[model samples]
Target: MPAVLVLLLLSGFLSRAEAATVVARVDLSSQRMTVSVNGVPRYSWLVSTARRGYVTPTGVYRPQRLYRMYYSRKYYNSPMPYSIFYSGGYAIHGSYAVSQLGGPASHGCIRLHPSNAATLYSLVQSYGRGNTAIVITR
Candidate 1:
């Protein structure tokens, strides 16, 4: 009986561990990204999303792919480090334009400081793609 109880407890613990969720919530108005792990807010960082004529789509999406280093063919071969692609051609990536952070600037993709982008990428990688969500809003 004790062995059966122990087995059940272990199963429950494992299930919980496997259910971890990481969410990156981007607020366009504030130009900030708030990262939450398992529904608990973990970190908040400044970000840049779309400037002037360009638009950053608002929706909830799961990360489709990750790249440690990527260069944009559409935009002057711009370097995008620690990129997390959540929408078609739209990614949350590290930007060299640190001075433009916390304001609209990017063509469309969300932009974070390199270190912050790396941190977020690591969190999503550790949590697994199935458990990661990206939510962009006004």
Candidate 2:
């Protein structure tokens, strides 16, 4: 009876861990970002990806690093609030240029509104690095 109870408890915990996965998809064609939890859309927002001259790599990746406050040393020391680095130096972060959203504007990173970025940062933090996936698509 004790062994059975322990197995059941472990099973429940495993299922919950699987269900907590969060997917963040960035569509370059539409310049939008959508976050879904367990296949249900939870958040959506406009974003600015790499401009025409620059390239934002498109592929499935996991969050490599997260920072509540980050400054880009390569980009004129710009503030990248709520930086979620997925690929190399590129990241999904908040931008001060709210008007440049909804189109390609950034050097290479995906840019979001300050508030929206903060919210996304919170969600990713809660779900944890092991449970979050970043999918960049055209």
Listing every candidate in turn, what is its Cα RMSD in Å to the true structure after a full C-alpha superposition? 8.3, 8.1
* Top-TM-score structure, candidate number: 1
Worst 10 contiguous positions by lDDT, candidate 2: 1-10
Tell me the TM-score of model 1.
0.85
Against the unseen true structure, what C-alpha lDDT does each candidate score? 0.85, 0.84
| lDDT of model 2, residue 91 | 97
lDDT of 1 by residue, 1-138 (tens): 223223323646224444437778899999999887766788999999999999999976778999999999999999999999988999999999999999999999999999999999999899888777677789
Clashing pairs in 1: none
- Assess the local accuracy of residue 106 in candidate 2 as a C-alpha lDDT between 0 and 100: 92
TM for every model, in the order presented, reads 0.85, 0.85
Instruction: List runs of model 1 lying over 4 Å from the truth.
Output: 1-20
Best by lDDT: 1
RMSD of 1: 8.3
